[model samples]
Target: MSEVKKIATRASYGSALVELGKEHDDLVVLDADLAAATQTGMFKKEFPDRHIDCGIAECNMVGIGAGLATTGKVPFVSTFAMFAAGRAYEQLRNSVAYPHLNVKVGATHGGISVGEDGATHQCCEDFALMRAIPGMVVMSPADDIEAKAMVKAAYEYVGPVYMRFGRLAVPVINDRPDYKFEMGKGIVLREGKDVTIVANGLCVAASLEAAEKLAADGIDAKVINIHTIKPLDEDLIVTAAKETGKVVTVEEHSVIGGLGGAVCECLSEKAPVPVKRIGVNDVFGESGPAVALLEKYGLDAEGIYKQVKEFV
Candidate 1:
């Protein structure tokens, strides 16, 4: 078998942003101090005329981006996930999300993958924060292809969209872009009868690997890539529950109010099945490599496989 190429979501976004900017003259890119860190360097290098750098002030950057968006120009603001969702929350809620502006907030360095930066940079609560904001399309792509697809989809959707991507280079799953990527629809990667594993972002890859390990143990684990958490794919989630009585949700985010929470909310009233949540146990992250942080937070492949085994 050929070795699959590994592409980080952040890098993919940088490339996609450049492509979008070239295609549409009205499209603009904005960054808050960390322009190079978030791959806005590509845009800055190509079209310095359109790229705006609002140094260190995320709230102000968001407001400025929203203001530009109101002028009929699509503004894509890049910053660390923690700042984009937390620091610029008011602007996101009122100026952008509430009014439904044509703005795309590309939040990189999300989850515990902002390795060596510690909890200050890790954005475990971004999913919850963005999901709570009505009219905000919260999307977390599983890999490079999905990241590119989601960016393109968000631009066409015509509203405020938040895309959370990490800095690490994980296995590049789903290389096919022809796959239909409708908002609020979860992609079912694997079908099984024993249990269903719903996951998104970096954890989606881990869940797929864990499902393979579970298969070796005679347990069929279904893997569902939950990209959009806000307008969740409730129908697909309920269908998984009806087919398999067990479920395990995995994410690189906190177990408190992340993808697992979304899954539980849907299943609590709809299907009501046995669920095992795999993610950060509501704690801050420490400085370490991304893989170490994942295991320490109990969101790695081993953690997911172990939790699913217990339910089985």
Candidate 2:
């Protein structure tokens, strides 16, 4: 069997920006002294004049991005999730989201997969924070293809957008001819009637693998990749929940107010099925190897498989 290709969503974000820069002259990129880490350096290298490094001040960088947007420029503010969504949250919420600017906040290194960077850097609450802002589009890509497509989509769609990317290289699962990318829509990867596994980001691939394990055990699991958190594909989730009678949401974020929370909120009112949220359970992550941390936190394929098996 051929080995699966893996690439970090952060790398995809950088490459996608370069692609968009070529097509749109008004597309500018701003970074908070994390161009290299956030992969915005790719854009800076291509368009030095359009790229702006706002030093280490994430808040000020957001302000600059917001200002640029007012002049009809689509600015993508790049930084670590901790800084972009956590540190500069006030500026993003007020300056960008409040006024509904055409600014994209590219937050890389989200969740416990940030590895040795530890609790301070790992931003598991960004989804919840971004989702709270009215009219803000929140998204997380599952692989390189989806990440690139999503970046372009965000640029084309005018408004405040928050996109989360992971440092860890994940497998390319959506490289099929039938694959499509649509904001606020869920993709059902596998069809089954036993239970529904709705996941996003790194967790989508893990959940797919877990579904395979479940299949081996005669537990048919329907897997859905919900890339968009805000303006979530509630109809898809509700339909899946109604068919399966049970739902399991997985994400590389805290269970509180992340994908799990969003799923629960949708189902409680519409479907009201039994749910199991697999993610960081309201606890801070410690410094550890990224893979090891995922295993420890029950975000790995084996962990998700075990949890889903028990739930079923």
Candidate 3:
């Protein structure tokens, strides 16, 4: 098999847009004056005419993207997750979600991984905000490979979509070029009977390690990679809850309303089980390295293992 072509989520959006733009003339890129940071610069370079930098006006950017989508254009709006989800939520709901527009909102720098940029830039509530939108498709990929796949999926998916990618260079677990991806489906990275650690984005890798550590302690841990928070794979989550009888949902976002919340909501309605959510508690992010932020907030692998330990 050929080597995997893993690109950062931001980079993937740039590269994939290059391909999508070539095939479809209606594909357009929009940035709230964050093209360089979000890697939408790649699209701007490739197709300058199709890229629009809307300056720091996030609300206007979202409105313009939704408008373009209504006019038969596929607009991929790139910006920081905080601004994309928090700053312009009304636009996302009223313009994009209400109209069911084909607008891909590519939010880079999600979670505390925005790091030194501090709390102002870190979007801990992004998932909660996006998930609350009725017609929004919330996706957060775990690695560069999956990030690329998710970006492609967002392009093809109709209606409002908020897909975020982080800044730090996380472990590239599935970098193989041949790997295919599907939205709204959780990928099973490992199988076990003791307990299930359901996670997505950066936590997928941490949970994998947590599961490994658990196995060494004679605790078989099942890891489910939930890349899509909205339209979550109910079958997979319910089955995992049934098989394990215990679960630990982890994510880089806040503990209140994110992946953990989504999983708990699912488990509560369908497969009731002991769930321990491992993520950022009610706290604002501080300036530090990405890993430090994750550790400080108890969103690391050790945190995941500890949370699972409680439920199991």
Global lDDT of each candidate: 0.89, 0.96, 0.86
Q: Cα lDDT for residue 289, model 1?
A: 93
Q: How high is the lDDT of residue 28 in model 1?
A: 92
- lDDT (Cα, tens digit) per residue for candidate 3, span 188-267: 89999998888988888888988887888899999999999998898999998899898888988888989889889988
**What TM-score fits each model?**
0.97, 0.99, 0.95
* Global Cα RMSD, each model: 1.5, 0.9, 2.5
* Best-matching candidate per TM-score: 2
lDDT of 1 by residue, 7-118 (tens): 7899989998988887889889999989778998998999999999999999999999999998999999999999999999999999998888999999999989888999
Judge candidate 3 against the unseen true structure and give its global Cα lDDT, from 0 to 1.
0.86
**Tens-digit per-residue lDDT, 22-134, candidate 2:** 99999999998999999999999999999999999999999999999999999999999999889998999999999999999999999999999999999999999999999
Question: Which rank order by lDDT, best down to worst?
Answer: 2, 1, 3
Residue-level error in angstroms, candidate 3, position 73: 0.7
Off by over 4 Å in 1: 1-3
Model 3 pairs in collision: 4-175, 4-176, 4-177, 142-201
Weakest ten-residue segment in model 1 by summed lDDT: 1-10
- Give the CA lDDT, 0 to 100, for residue 131 in model 1: 89
